[model samples]
Target: MPDVMPLVTAVDQLADRLRSLPQSRLRQGAAAHGLDLARELSARAQRLEFPDREPRSVPDEGLFVVADQVAVTGRDLAEAMRTASAHEVAEAVKLVEEAARRCEGTG
Candidate 1:
């Protein structure tokens, strides 16, 4: 049987990181969406019965939220990229990359 603990741990860590990010419009939106995804994953993990014939895998519900976050964050970042100062542009790029990485299961 595949171990699901790592996936759960990753999701939890990503959620915590998102929550603790600085309070910018992009981070705020992503944090809210990420927390919702994390809550859903936690709830699903608690309900798993691990029956003998079942396949062990993390639930896909969080994927939708991740995609949503990416879209929203990407849009916001694009706006920042268009007019922000050098430091702000760099920060926006970092935020967008982080969101994409989380969606790709590498964050």
Candidate 2:
């Protein structure tokens, strides 16, 4: 299995940042970005775990749940990628890293 600590770290960091954001900030754009990232990550995991089926969309459950959604989805992706190729793992890492950078608003 590939080392997934990097993905874990990146996603954890993003989730913590999102959780710490003030409600005002979350309302501004943080939650939106977090939700987007969560949705994308969820899709990636679904594809990894079930490539034959169309991935379902992660619902917009509201701003408050964004952080948890992101965290859970990230973990799900990490789990699904455990049996994946190195290139696939690297792609996931890159995705999380980019999302982290873009989620600066949540920090």
Candidate 3:
């Protein structure tokens, strides 16, 4: 608690490093998920359109594309989530080890 600067700096560096990753790699699952989420949201939004508003099939078609994307993203996310727990456990162990080292050094 006395000094959080190192943690903040570490987090910032990690974020910057992540930001430097290739866009294609970053968006690997995004297009699909974005399209899906957008489609679902659009469908819900369309239903809220004014009763007298002119019908638009074009929007519906666009939403279909989005829905497809969402499906792809969902699949990717599910796989990632499944593997993520293991990674989380490893990271937690690493953090504990690092903290123990620091405590020993200080003591």
The prediction achieving the highest TM-score against the true structure is 2
CA lDDT of each candidate? 0.41, 0.87, 0.35
- Pick by TM-score: 1 or 2, better one: 2
Worst 10 residues of 1 by lDDT: 42-51
User: Order of all candidates by TM-score, from best down to worst?
Assistant: 2, 1, 3
Q: Report the C-alpha lDDT of model 3 over 1-107, residue by residue, as the tens digit.
A: 12323333432332333344345533454233333343433332233343356433223233224334333333333333333345533443344234323322331
**Which lDDT tens digits does candidate 2 get at residues 41-76?**
999999988999999998999989999999999999
User: Can you list the residue pairs that collide in candidate 1?
Assistant: none
- Report the Cα lDDT for residue 66, model 3: 37
TM-score per model over all chains:
0.34, 0.91, 0.26
For candidate 2, the C-alpha RMSD (Å) to the true structure equals 1.6
What global local distance difference test value does model 2 have? 0.87
Q: On residues 43-98, what C-alpha lDDT tens digit does candidate 1 reach at each position? A: 33333323244333323343334444433334433332343345544544444445
| Clash totals in order | 0, 0, 4
C-alpha RMSD in Å of predicted model 1 compared with the true structure: 16.5
